[model samples]
Target: MLVLIGGAAGTIAFDLFGRAISPILGFASLNPIGLARGFLGTLGLPNSGAYGHLMHLLFVGLLAYPIGWLFVARPVFSRVLVGLHWAFASAAYGVGLWVFAIGGIAWFAGNPAFLGFAPIAWVALVAHVLYSVVTAATINYIERLQHAR
Candidate 1:
């Protein structure tokens, strides 16, 4: 549960940061946020709108908190949850990579000069990977706390 909550929180936090920085950095309005909406919609989930995006973030956070509590509340589930966390994290990373590649290619094709965005992409990718790692570590630590309790 900690894993889920952490995952959701991580997702929301990243989205918020991405939305805030995208325009400042001259990224397309549809870059990260649009990618998220499209991916969620593809999975038949609700897409985040300007207003609803905040709600969705809260929703994910709420769902994750309880799951975290559950895992923390039960010792036996800790290991299983941790394993699941890594599995999901891996999958999410893969999806993120796919989205980045597709979006980057499309953007570059339309604006050949957009290769200037390469440094931005590189920086963003590094930050993203770091975020994922931290989220995974947080989940793991939370699980350990649950087990220790």
Candidate 2:
């Protein structure tokens, strides 16, 4: 469905920024695969590279995160932040994801909390926002197309 497509698009954006753009810009890059692997390790699960790929790409990026955006985040924010644009709200959701996944989960995965507020943490922040923005844009575009039909 469109949701899945949006999610996949966003995930690709996240990876592109984290792996290519951030590093080229002199910031530490994000490795979602490693993070997923470490998180699985923390949970006493398989933590193989294959498993990490599945967890990050299939589960979190393509399913849970998008559902969270459409169901939980948008609804809550629309109510609380009347008149705020969806893109900004999506960016806020990205920040929340960074807090939960990076700040909190990464710690359990053995990285310093918030990367000890290091440069990488800021880079990660931008990546997260980019992910959400792309996701919202994709979904919006799809919906608008459908409505136009």
Instruction: Write model 1 residue lDDT over 1-149, tens digit each, in one string.
Output: 56565666566545554555654776633254444354456556676675245433444333533243334423433455665555355435534643453445335334333235565455445445544544555666776898999
Q: How does model 2 fare in lDDT?
A: 0.91
Candidate 2: regions farther than 4 A off: none
**Cα lDDT of model 2 by residue, 102-132, tens digit:** 8998899999998899888888898888888
Which residue pairs in candidate 2 have backbone atoms (N, alpha carbon, C) closer than 3 angstroms, thus clashing? none
**TM-score to native of every candidate shown:** 0.43, 0.96
Residue 12 deviation, candidate 1, in Å? 4.7
TM-score of 1: 0.43
lDDT of 1: 0.48
Q: Highest lDDT among the candidates is held by which one?
A: 2
